[model samples]
Target: MSSDLFDRIAAIGVIPVIAIENAAQAVSLADALLEGGLPLAEITFRTTAAAEVMATLRDKRPELLVGAGTILDSASLDAAKASGALFGLAPGYDAEIVAEAGRIGLPFAPGIMTPSELGAALKQGARLCKFFPAGTAGGPAALAGISTPFAHLGCRFIPTGGVTEANLPDWLAVKDVLAVGGTWIATTSDIANGRWAEIAAKTRAAVARVREARGG
Candidate 1:
C-alpha cells in the first residue's frame, strides 16, 4: 500500500505542502489544484487549523489526495488519521513513530538528511523517505551522492523544503528522486491574499516542468 501511494505520488511528480489557516479555504484550494491538473496536497500541522482543514478537504473534496505533514509524534499521527489523512510526513525519522504508524497501517515517509538516518529508516522497513530541507542538504547534487549506496536497496526519495520551480528540474533529473514537495506553489501569504489563480498557474507550470524533464 505504501509503495502504491508513492507510485501515485511519483506519477504526479510534485506535492504541494500547504498550510491552510482557514478551514473555509480548503475546498477552493483543492479546486484550484484540480483546475491546474494536480490533485495532491500535503497539509502541514504547523497551524491550529490544520486538522480541521484536512478533514474539510478530505470530506468535501474526496478527489484530492490529502496527506498530513509536520507530524512529530503519535498524537499528531492519530489526529491525522482521525481527520482522514491518507499519509503522514515527519520532519525527521523516529523509531517509535514508525512503529506506531505501522501498527495502525498508516502510510508514512520520515525525513532523512544523512546516510545514517536513511539506514535507520530502512531498518525500520521504510522504502521511501523524505530528503528534507533539500536545498540546505546540498540540493540535488547532495541527494544524488547520498543515494548511491541506497540505490541497491531500492530506496526512493521525495525531497522537500526550499524546492522551487527554478531548481525543480535539477531535483527531478536525479533518478532516485521520485517526487518533490514545495510550499512555493501555494505559500501562506498567497493563501492569505486569496491568490488561487496564481497558485493554479504555478502548479500548471510546475507540472509542465516535470513532464518536460521526464520527456513525458
Candidate 2:
C-alpha cells in the first residue's frame, strides 16, 4: 500500500460515505464537497448507480480522492476498479477480497469490530481499518479500549457507521482514529434539489468540527 494514499485520506479529515440514488448527482455532489474544503469521498456500491457515479466523478473531478465502499466480493472490486475508484472499502474484512485488492494495487480499508477481526485484518497486511456501526460498537470508547492494547500493532481506524456531527469530536479525539465517514453532509434532498451551496455549508461545518476536535 502506498503511504501517500493514507496521507491523502488523512488530509481531508473526514471521508463522506455517500450513497447516490441518482448518478447525475455524483459530479455536483463531489464538487460541493471540494468547494467546502473537503477533497475526499467514498461512494458506496449499495445502489445501482454506484459504478456510474464513480465513473462520472472520476472524469469530472479527478482531483477528488474517490473510494468505492460496500465492496464485498471480487466482482464488485473489479467493477469498482474499472470505474476509476482510487481505493476500496469493505463493510467487513474478507481475506479473499483483501488479497484481491492488494493484487490489483488498490488500497483497502476493511471493517472490523472485535480484536479478533482486527488481528485477522492485520494478518492480511491491512494496517488501516474501518470500525463499522461505530456507535453500536461502543463508539470512541470501543476504539480507545482496543487501542490501549493493540496500538503497538501499528493499526489505525476510520470510524464510519453511526458517525454524526454530534459525536465526531469524540471519535476524532481518539488516537487510533485516522478519519471519520458519514453522509449527513450530502443528504439525498440536498442532491435532489441541486443544493450545492447548502451541501458546502454543511461540509464546512463538519470540517470545522474536525479541526476543533484536533485542537487546530
Q: Rate the local accuracy (lDDT) of all candidates.
A: 0.89, 0.88
lDDT (Cα, tens digit) per residue for candidate 1, span 1-216: 376777888999999998889888888788889999899999999988999998998889989888999999888999999999998888899999988988988888899999999999999988878999898999998999988988998888899988988888889999778899999888899888889999899889989988988887
Look at candidate 2 and give me any clashing residue pairs. none
Quality of model 2 by C-alpha lDDT: 0.88
Name the weakest run of 10 consecutive residues (lDDT summed) in model 1: 1-10
Which pairs clash inside model 1? none
| TM-score against native, each model | 0.97, 0.96
Instruction: Write the residue-wise lDDT of candidate 2 on 1-216 in tens digits.
Output: 468988778766798888888998888898899889998989898888999999998899999889999999998899899999998898898999999999998889899989888989998899889898788899899888876778888888999889999889988889968899998988777787899999999999999988898888
Scored against the true structure, residue 204 in model 2 reaches a CA lDDT of 94
Which stretches in model 2 have alpha-carbon errors above 4 Å? none
